[model samples]
Target: MATDGQILRLAQWLSPAYPVGAFAYSHGLESAVATGAVADGAALTDWLADILRFGAGRSDTIFLRAAYEAPPEDLPRIDALACAFQPSAERRTETTAQGAAFARVTAAVWPDDLPDFTYPVALGRAARLHDLPLGLTARLNLQAFLSNLVSAGIRLIPIGQTEGQRVLTALQPLCEEVAGLALTETLDDLAGTSFLADIASMTHETQYSRLFRT
Candidate 1:
């Protein structure tokens, strides 16, 4: 279980104001919107739900737990696997850059030796160092991840704020399921079957006019 202060720390780390530059990256959502694969709040919800269950959400949770449970000396191996799991150059940039930024900011404020690994790995290690509960950390991480993408959808789809919130609300159960499933899985199960999402990311790399980095 997590103490209130510990939970608050998780919220603080994943909050938009944390300066992870999350707003600048859409995780291929920009392309999905432009291509009309995600034109409305409902579509956005379904698309992001797939991503959470089969893509980065599932894999990152595994990596996060791997980092949390592993001997500290073995974190680099997990980080290597996380980096290698990315499907494209931009995808790699998205995770690694955010990871470095997250580690740098968190280390400065909390005074830890948090390494600049991929984002999930960095966050997992930080939560462990802070003595936060693993399940709560993973759950909130999934929520914050979905929340960020829904925010991106709000801007790209030009949906009303209420609709955006609704999309997020619709995703809550899926996030819970993925977070729960992730806790039961191991690194070997870190696989992504979201090929269309990966293609959207690759296509975004050369999109003529883009608003996101990946």
Candidate 2:
């Protein structure tokens, strides 16, 4: 179980106001919306579900878990794998940029020597460095990712705030389930199975009118 301070720290790190620049990236939902691939709340939920189960979300979970347990000497190799796993330039930029930004701020506040880490790698280091419980760390990170994506969906589609919240609420079980799986997974388990989501992220790069950097 997490203490109050641990919970607070994790919450602050994942908060929208944390300065990770998460708002600028929609995780490719913008392109999906533009192409009408995601037209409603149900579609949005299914899309995000696939992503949580088989896409970057799944990969990040493995990376996060591995980083949490990996020795300090192994982080670089892990970070390298994460960097190489990105399927597209924008996807790479999104993770690397956010990871770099996270490293910058946490360097001042949390003050770790995690050089050139991807977001999941950096987050794993932070979680371990701070001695946060692995279960809480996994669930919090997954929930934060889902929340950011849901916020994007609300803006891109006609989904109301309430509906978006509903989508998020519905995903909580899957989020925990993924988090649970990540606790036992290894980097070798890293696989992105949501081809459509990957394609949408690639397609987002050329979207004529775009609302997100990724």
Candidate 2 Cα outliers beyond 4 Å, as residue runs: none
lDDT of 1 by residue, 1-214 (tens): 5788998999899999998898899999999889999888878888998899899999999999999998889999999999999998899999999999999999999799998999999999998999999999999999988888988888898798999999989889989999999999999887899988999999999999988898
| Model 2 root mean square deviation, Cα atoms | 0.8
Alpha-carbon lDDT, every model? 0.91, 0.91
Could you give me the TM-score of model 2 versus the true structure?
0.98
Residues 1-214 of candidate 2: C-alpha lDDT, one tens digit per residue? 7999999999999999999899999888998999999999999999999999998878998998898899999999999999999988899999999999988998888678766589999999988989998789889999999999999999999799999999999999999998898678888777888998899999999889988999
Error of 1 at 199 (Å): 0.4
Model 1: lDDT of residue 112: 94
The number of residue pairs in model 2 that clash at the backbone is 0
